[model samples]
Target: TQLLEQSPQFLSIQEGENLTVYCNSSSVFSSLQWYRQEPGEGPVLLVTVVTGGEVKKLKRLTFQFGDARKDSSLHITAAQPGDTGLYLCAGADGNKLVFGAGTILRVKS
Candidate 1:
């Protein structure tokens, strides 16, 4: 079975700080996606990385896919309180999606 493990399950930082979170797996995936979720809401797709070593940026956020396609990372620059949310990494396996344990981030103003 494909599985993803995310590091630092929880985080707390001040506004304007930067942080990076990681997702790792032993199994290779055809594609990987990142999502962000707010309290009481479903996760919103942030970006999708298909090729190995691919990187995508959205404003202050950066996503990277490992060269082996088994890992990924998310970096936030000058985070704001509004950036606080649950971040998740998911891998595509056939018709199914294998998700990581998700990282919860809190940015205090």
Candidate 2:
């Protein structure tokens, strides 16, 4: 079985501070996805990286897929308090999805 492991289980930062979280796996995936989950809402798909070495940016956030397709990272620039939430990384392997433990982010005002 393949598993995604996320680093820095928790992150607490002040508004405007930049941070980066990582997701890694031993298995290669065809595609990987990033999601953000707020307190009461289900996770919303943020981005999906299919090609290795691809980089995608959404506003102040950037998502990157590893050259080997076995790792990924999420970086936020000048983060705001509104960004506080649980960030998850999932790898799509064939018909199954393997999820990371998730990183909890708390951005203080």
Candidate 3:
């Protein structure tokens, strides 16, 4: 069985602050995808880190996949109001999918 867990189920921040969210698991994953979803809208693919120990950066956001392929991290630099939303981490094993508990980020301006 594969499962993903995220820390600090929720987060609220003032505009311009920074934050980090974590995802962990015991089972190794083939690939992992990170998504940010806004209210009333489907999640948008923020990034995907497939290689172990690989890191990808998108503007103020940075993502890293664990060397063991069982963990991941997201770092937001200078968070703004536009960054507020639900962040979801997903692990894919062939056609099956497992998701983290989810993190709700609120950025107040």
Q: What are the TM-scores, per candidate, against the unseen true structure? A: 0.98, 0.98, 0.96
- Candidate numbers sorted by lDDT from highest down: 2, 1, 3
Task: For candidate 3, write residues 19-86 as lDDT tens digits.
Answer: 99999999999999999999999889889889999999999999999999999999999999999999
lDDT of 2: 0.96
Candidate with maximal lDDT: 2
RMSD of every candidate to native, in Å, equals 0.6, 0.6, 0.8
> Model 2: per-residue lDDT, tens digit, 1-109?
9999998899999999999999999999999999999999999999999999999999999999999999999999999999999999999988778899999999999
Which model, 2 or 3, shows the larger lDDT?
Answer: 2
Model 3 spans with C-alpha error above 4 angstroms: none
Show the colliding residue pairs in model 3: none
Q: Pairing residues by index, what is the TM-score of model 1?
A: 0.98
- Which 10-residue window of candidate 3 scores lowest in summed lDDT? 92-101
Model 2 CA RMSD to the hidden true structure, in angstroms? 0.6
Tens digits of per-residue lDDT, candidate 1, 1-109, equal: 8889998899999999999999999999999999999999999999999999999999999999999999999999999999999999999998688999899999999
